[model samples]
Target chain A: MGEKIKVDRVTKTFVVRDSDQKGARKEFTAISNMEFSVKEGEFLTIVGPSGCGKSTLLDLLGGLSTPTKGRILLDGQEIKGPGLDRGTVFQQYALFPWKTARGNIEFGLEAKGIPKREWRAQSDHYLELVGLKSFADRYPHELSGGMKQRVAIARSLAFNPDVLLMDEPFAALDAQTRETLQSELLRIWEKTKKTIIFITHGIDEAVYLGQRVVILSANPGRIKKIVEIPLKHRLADADIRSNPEFVKARHQVWSLLHEDEYAGLYI
Target chain B: MVAISKQVKSAKRLHKLTINPLLALQKLVKQSIVLLLFFVVWEIAPRIGLVDPAFFPAFSEVASAWWNMLLSNELFSHFSASITRSIAGFGLAIAIAIPLGLVIGWYPIARDLLNPILELFRNTAALALLPVFILLLGIGETSKIAIVFFACTWPILLNTIAAVRNVDPLLIKSARSMNISSFSLFYKVILPASIPTMFTGIRMAGTGAILVLIAAEMVGAKEGLGYFITYSQYNFMIPEMYAGILTISILGLIINYGLLALEKRLSRWKQDPTV
Candidate 1:
């Protein structure tokens, strides 16, 4: 596969004002020197502790925010702003509370400027893909955490973007649901063949999900290391967490993350 | 999507209302006990001379006075007059404040520019400005409606601003990532999300609409419930005044619950209907 996305020395900085300090300006760097590219149809997982600018990186890739330093290129075109070419699954689900499961999926299709008459069919197809066909009419408030995340995934995929950027999408789910969703995500990714960049703080999640695990460090976040994982675990035919190769890979990610005390993996 | 939701709606309706009618009615009566008790006390207290009937009439006396006005059709004119003014002022305020609030809430520059003026006007009570409105617009229907409009604006405006501001940032971020157009974002995400909170402001403004209009009418008005009450009071028709007060109370209750039902309908997704 050819390069699908290129983050060429991307850096994000936010200007924040202190409430107590009148007219005082301060600069906070969320992420810096994020130089990486994703190949087409690659399942890349990024692992880092909280506040490591993983979310910032995802925001930049999604075109919700622009990089302070360098530009991001998608299929060799500069990404100036948000576009329908990229779909994102936020950590918070971010499903509109007012919309039903089907309505939420239609949000993407509508943004993509797809015909109104086809929204229902496309939305239902994605809902079934995430195995929530029966809950099509249900709202986010009525859904469980895992169910809501599934709907979020369906929402992003329904838009049919070139790449899907996820920011700790399953971090809030319980152990069993998280594992089940990981397997399901792999299956869906295989079927769709969409390039995915999944961000997480879990060692096992990174090892199990990604073709390559990109480790990041906090406090002026920068790429720490990128570890290539075993192929079988990445393909995920079945529960592979107990596999020796998976454990070894997980340990390597764990050790790499813990080298810096502040960047220790919480999971 | 529409068909699926409709099916769910019917299924839910069927699953609900399984409660026996008798039990539901019994529960309703149980909840009404305190209100019934208060009315009972008012009736007995005046009749027993706990409070002199000359000053505070008995409930039966008030009821008879109310019935007399109802039969003579005197109450209908006043009720209609008061309602028309309240609705006009309230509707105008909603039509203006909601759009203005949405704009100010969403845009930082707009919010900053208008905030000082809003605070200044907000603290100046609507009733306190009645003299100014009368002086400027005169003591006619225009002034009365204007006062209600002024009184109602703050609650609806402030609440709407807060509602727009308090919309979950995550929702907007996600929507923006999908390249949702600015116009679509307003109605699709911001407007619906703001409904529940905005309704709170609107309900408060509903109460303000009545209270402010009545006070304005009492100042100088010919045909309204407020004028009726003050007229009856001046003539020492205590029972008639009480009747007018009762009618106002009922009107307020109806307005409140009506808005509440409308709010519940628009924001149906907010509630867990199954529960």
Candidate 2:
């Protein structure tokens, strides 16, 4: 499978107040000349520093916001605002607090106008996929942070969208939980074979999960380099940590980030 | 350290046994004490001549008047009349406010055109329109009920508009991405989320309906608690007037509790987790 979604020369800028001038607004660029494409059923992660506008790029692809310039195409069609083909999972769980886990997962299918009987089976299937079958009847507040994030992923995937866009879904969890959820997410990705574009601030997460890691620079975020992962199958977590080549890639990415950070301060 | 640990364990057991029962009794005993204090003051005020017995009837006199009203079955008739009017008027308001609010809230042009007019009318006292309603509808049940409807509608309409307008943007975006579009969006996404807030408005409208009913009855109606109070005052039946006031208070309490119970049942999802 090759390239289900393509972004071309996407640029997004918001108006900001000029620091030196009183009451004067200036154009502040968030993302400039950003270009990428997700191969059909490929899992990719974009990793960068805090203000690199990784989220801005995700929103553009997810169709929550329109790019100021250029275009995004899915299956050779120009992308418009949010469509059913692309599903997004936010950093916060964003599940409806009023709905139980089952209710929330079924929301997408409900909107699709599926019959009520079908919703029960479909929703329960996805609930079990995320290992929340036991807690299906429970509300969002009933779950811990990791469980809530799992529910969010289940909700996005329940509708069987063509592309999944996730914006740092597990960043809020503790270190141990984050690692666990990362592996769970990889497992889900492998089983489902859905095209995924994940945004993150963590280097380890990007290297661990991505077929191709797109490193972005801060201040008018642009792609600095694309690092391809050669390891094809699941490697032991300890083995990946101990590999000499993995250490080299980590250090190389760290230095690139350092350069971007220093350059950003002067700007 | 061993002795200290044993003492802490015993204290924990003691706490488990006594705390729950003590909390329940504390709540009940506190309320009972307040009521007892009120009755004590009421009984003493007339006997001590703090207030003259002629104008301010004794507690026993008011109690006897209450018993007489109940025995005559007149109190029940007045209570029923007031309740029917308030409920009918409030029901009418709900029928009108919901669709109008949705239209106005969803469309910016409609909201800009209509909102100022709504704000103007809401601030205008509903009782001030009583004479106008009487002039138009001829001082009968229609005029009185119209007044109650006018008073009750504003809160419901305003709250509907607010709840619709203030739905979280993130939720809407999330819904749209999931392919939830215009019509289903309102019913599934907007309406369910807005319900808790909308129920707040409904509760307010319930109170407003009862309040306006009382005032409306004072004008020309023959069969409500407000009319009974006015009639008693006219005939110099001071104790009976107090009895009517007491009946209205209990009626208000019942209506409030009824709406609250319904709200709780409908909004189980919003139940506070801490409790």
lDDT of 1 by residue, A126-158 (tens): 999988898899888777778889899999999
DockQ in order: 0.48, 0.36
Q: Candidate 1 — which residues are off by over 4 angstroms?
A: A16-26, A233-237, A261-267, B1-23, B272-275
lDDT of 1 by residue, B93-149 (tens): 999999999999999999999999999999999999999999999988999999999
- Estimate, for each residue in B1-275, the C-alpha lDDT of model 2 and write its tens digit: 23324433553453364557879999899879988888678767887899987667777788899999999998899989988888888889989987788778888899999988999999999988888998999877788778888998899889988889998887887787776668888888888778787888888998888888898888888889999999999999998998898898888888889988988877777756455
* CAPRI category for model 2: acceptable
Q: TM-score of the second chain in each model?
A: 0.92, 0.88
Write out the backbone clash pairs for model 1.
none
Q: In terms of DockQ, which candidate is strongest?
A: 1
